[model samples]
Target: MVPVAPTVLFLINEHIATEALLGEAFTDHGFDVETFEVVPAERAEDPAGHVTFPDPAGYDVIAPLGATWPVYEPALRDTWVGDEMQLMRDAAAGGTALLGVCFGGQLLAQTFGGSVARSPRPEIGWCEVTSDRSDIVPGGPWFQWHFDRWSLPPGATELARTADSSQAFVLGRALALQFHPEVDTELLKVWLAADSNGEALQAGITHDELLTRTEELAVDTAARVRRLVAGFLTYLAGQPRPS
Candidate 1:
């Protein structure tokens, strides 16, 4: 008999981004990965009530990726924000593991009774974190590009943090991460180039400098992502899957 591969859904959101290294890492770890976008392109500027997210059934993992929107905005909360949060809650209740990245992490925190707010100091480019579980979250510079941070949800364990905010947390099978473990030079190029109003410049990082650093760190970053996924899978192994 042949072993069947586990499936994962990568919620790419409305942004022009990919799972990049993160989705690839999961594939290397033997999981079938699928991509979904919650906000339709026509409604990118105002996604509220424009989309209905897919029901997460049969997938072993549901990973909500980064986005350009803030999770705390009241306008969003009334529409797709509430909708997606409900989806996350439903997936969690049904035993699908949740992995929320950046904005996704903030949303996960919000859904799980925590809060998301603008950080006193926003993080961009590659930033270092102090990890309580370094074997999983790691301590070295991980890619970050968000101005918001998540308050630890009830029953969630803090895995890593920085002075600005919580960097990573875990609750049951769910892993919420503030950093981008899947970022690579190409993806960063796509993102920075698409920043119409110069988001990186506003954050004090130049496009050339950031991409240069990414080139220097790409090798190590990929290794860290690989190890991070392995550690995460091992951690998930100990949790109960929905029957």
Candidate 2:
């Protein structure tokens, strides 16, 4: 049978800048990607009101980007009501790939029987991740921007880590990343300027610091991200289903 084009769904909660950066990454990979920006009724509350689940049959992959976890998590859970956990459960079970970045990563874990809660320290600026599973993730420092962290769900493989938190997890064809490997210098500037992260800049973290670090990050990280995407695609390709 001829393979169908892989269709990917993107669930975005942050404003245009973040989603645009990530979308560019997806487009670069040659996947057919569709996106939705779930606007929360309250930035700090549940996003249940804005929750949306399009026909899963149409997409081979699903990606949820970073946002206020409080808002996105409830919405995703409430979208399924009694079977909230099954959102990811069913996806993984059916061989559909899921990639969650930062807040989205937390949601993926929470939906898959893991815990997502506030970290002891908020890792807001550029940082690094240690990779015990270097075959799956590149070692050394990776970028981070989260106040929360996740414990791996049962049967999940942890592909990346840092002193601060668990960085990445893989269950079947699905993967979740705590750090922002998708980020670049331009995106970094826009994110720093955004209201959601303005406090970090005002607290003496200058744009220059971020730009310099992200540039250093891009040097090695682009290859890592490409490898990760290819790895995930390989997993999806090996799935029982034909896509």
Candidate 3:
């Protein structure tokens, strides 16, 4: 039988550049991808509040890209959180892969009964991640930009960590990453230009610092992210179809 094209849903809560880069990456991996810009029309309003989509059962994978706070704040935290959680659980239950990046990772943790709250110390810029599961996230430095942290969900395995945060987690075929291994220079520039790095960025971190780290290891880091995503897809394909 000819293999069916696996449909992948790319959630662009905000950060259009990131949405494009991630979609391109997955497309290169041989999956059909679609993107949605879910920013609410009104400020301080829920973006998803005004949008609608069918069940996640239609997709072979659900990937929520990292975004600026205005995108995830009042909107995602309120109106969209539950629905996204349901979508995540449904995808996992249906044996479809689920990969969450940054705030996307927080969403995944919460879906699995974990808590998402401000970290003791907000991690900004590039930081070294020690992989607890080397098979998933190979140890090295991964880019981080967030003021929050998450508790690993029940039955979830932590893939990586830093001095201040649990950087990555995995549950079933689901994978959650607090850092942006998928971050490319263009997106970085746009994100910096918008001054959306949150409290961490405001704490005196410099763009030069981030550029230096990412530039020094861009090739290697991309390779690690590839390994991580490939591992998740392998797990997803191995799962039995739901009865």
Which one wins on TM-score? 1
- Per-residue lDDT of model 3, residues 1-243, tens digit only: 999877788777664436544566567688888876555325423344544545778888888777655223555656666667777777777777788988888889888888887777777777888887776677787777777888889898887889888988888777888988777777777667766534545766777776776678877866776776666676654466667
Query: Which ranges in model 3 have alpha carbons more than 4 Å from their true place?
Result: 40-50, 70-76, 196-201
Report the Cα RMSD per candidate.
1.5, 3.6, 2.8
Task: State the lDDT of candidate 1 residue by residue for 1-243, as single tens digits.
Answer: 999999889987766757999898999989998888777677777676745788787788899888888987788888878888999999998888888899888989999999998888779888888898877777899989988888888999999987788999999889999998989988988898778998788888899999999999989999989988887888863377867
Q: Compared to the true structure, candidate 3 yields what TM-score?
A: 0.86
Q: Candidate 2 residues 187-240, lDDT tens each?
A: 777666664646566545766787787787786777777666666666643466
Better of 1 and 2 by TM-score: 1
Clashes of each: 0, 3, 1
The 10-residue segment of model 1 with minimum total lDDT is 234-243
lDDT score for candidate 1 against the true structure: 0.86
The residue ranges of model 1 lying beyond 4 angstroms of the native Cα positions read: none
